[model samples]
Target: MKRLLALTLALLPTLATAGQITLILSDKIETSDGKICLYENAVKSEQVKVTASAQCRHTMTFED
Candidate 1:
């Protein structure tokens, strides 16, 4: 998680001037009770939602 965050931070400067940048990170995990949990970043695009599982998603949008 730290690495992911670091990577995202590292890329921010480059992407800042690149118009709009959308970063999506997702992960699926099973809880202690054996329940499948989905985590994802909130996105309004149906296309993204349909293509990506919400099993731990982190979405970050940046615009220049």
Candidate 2:
């Protein structure tokens, strides 16, 4: 178990940033509109309520 734990620990960071994800927030925002918010490896929430035009973009890269 020790070796497995060590291996997992060593690879945790690499695995964490192994992929790229993009989030595109629309320019049109409204209480009835829905937006995507990502947290960690998956979406934290959906159908965000907003009241105005908003645009956002996010990108992440991994390096050894």
Evaluate all candidate structures by whole-model CA lDDT and list the values in order. Answer: 0.50, 0.45
Write the residue-wise lDDT of candidate 2 on 1-64 in tens digits.
9999999999999787766443333333334564443323355222333333543334322232
Q: Which portions of model 2 show Cα errors greater than 4 Å?
A: 21-64
- Spell out the clash pairs found in candidate 2: none
**Model 2 alpha-carbon miss at residue 16, Å:** 0.6
Per-residue error for 12 in candidate 2, Å, reads 0.4
Give lDDT tens digits, candidate 1, residues 1-64. 9999999999999776677656554544455544333333454221133223333335646442
Per-model TM-score, in order, reads 0.28, 0.31
Give the lowest summed-lDDT range of ten residues in model 1: 44-53
